[model samples]
Target: MGAAQGDDQDEWSFLFGMLMDDATKRGLAHDELYFLSDELLRFSLAYQGYEPLLEAVADGELSRLRFMHEIWRAMPEHFYVDLALKLGAELLAARQ
Candidate 1:
């Protein structure tokens, strides 16, 4: 269910920017940064929710927010900072 790489980059950039802006203002600690990021991710997933009933129809089919699952699976402890770092690395890797 992943969007195109170009699309994900643009969207992720906006998300990362917004999260960083608030994180900077709050002077959030490591733990708090992740807490805020997780919340933001949750909100994004909630906003994207559309196929609630259809998601579970197939056994192997991905549910909602498949990209999120990808990000989380790549992250350390599912931290937001880690997500950014990993996503950045993935972007860089894509270029090579």
Candidate 2:
């Protein structure tokens, strides 16, 4: 990968780590977080529109929470519901 691409990936990784930390605090299981983070990475890679937002987050110009909010807003409702259900199921399973 080019230096810029590598930089973006590093930034993305940093942002993903922040998100995973937040999700862990909210009680998301490791497996669920893994799947969610993977999905998010895929989404960001496939969508160029999110590059600017990711760049902003990486540059420290935007809060991670705001980055999440923007991503959530952009995600389809059905997609969000599916991930939510999967996460909830994992949480319930973990509790048992």
Candidate 3:
């Protein structure tokens, strides 16, 4: 956790807040909205990939960012772009 990492986290928070606001404006039921958020959290956890991804990273067969993007590949484009725009900044910072 460095300054830029913290900043990226803040940006992600802002973006998700904006997205949830949009969801409310669209009249999504509270439970539906919650489910949407939960799905994202679940997908994020899937991207972290229990053990295989860690092994891949250790073996140099994959980068963590690439593994994360593989999860993003399963998402809707709009959701993916919204997350990726911020997440990419985080991953890029992590790489450096």
State which candidate, 1 or 3, has the greater TM-score. 3
Residue-wise C-alpha lDDT for candidate 1, range 35-55, written one tens digit per residue: 434454555445443333224
lDDT of 1 at 67: 33
Stretches off by above 4 angstroms in model 3 are 1-7, 30-96
Q: In terms of TM-score, which candidate is stronger, 2 or 3?
A: 2
In order of listing, the candidates' clash counts read 0, 0, 0
Q: What TM-score fits each model?
A: 0.28, 0.30, 0.29
Query: What is the alpha-carbon lDDT for the whole of candidate 1?
Result: 0.46
- How would you encode candidate 3's per-residue C-alpha lDDT over 10-52 as one tens digit per residue? 4444555555566568887433454334345456555433445
Model 3 has an lDDT value of 0.51
Alpha-carbon RMSD of each model: 14.6, 15.3, 15.7
Q: Give the Cα lDDT of each candidate.
A: 0.46, 0.58, 0.51
| Residue-level error in angstroms, candidate 3, position 35 | 7.4
lDDT of 2 at 66: 50
- Candidate 2 residue-wise lDDT, 41-93, digit = tens: 44654643466776776686855545554554454445567889999999999
Best by lDDT: 2
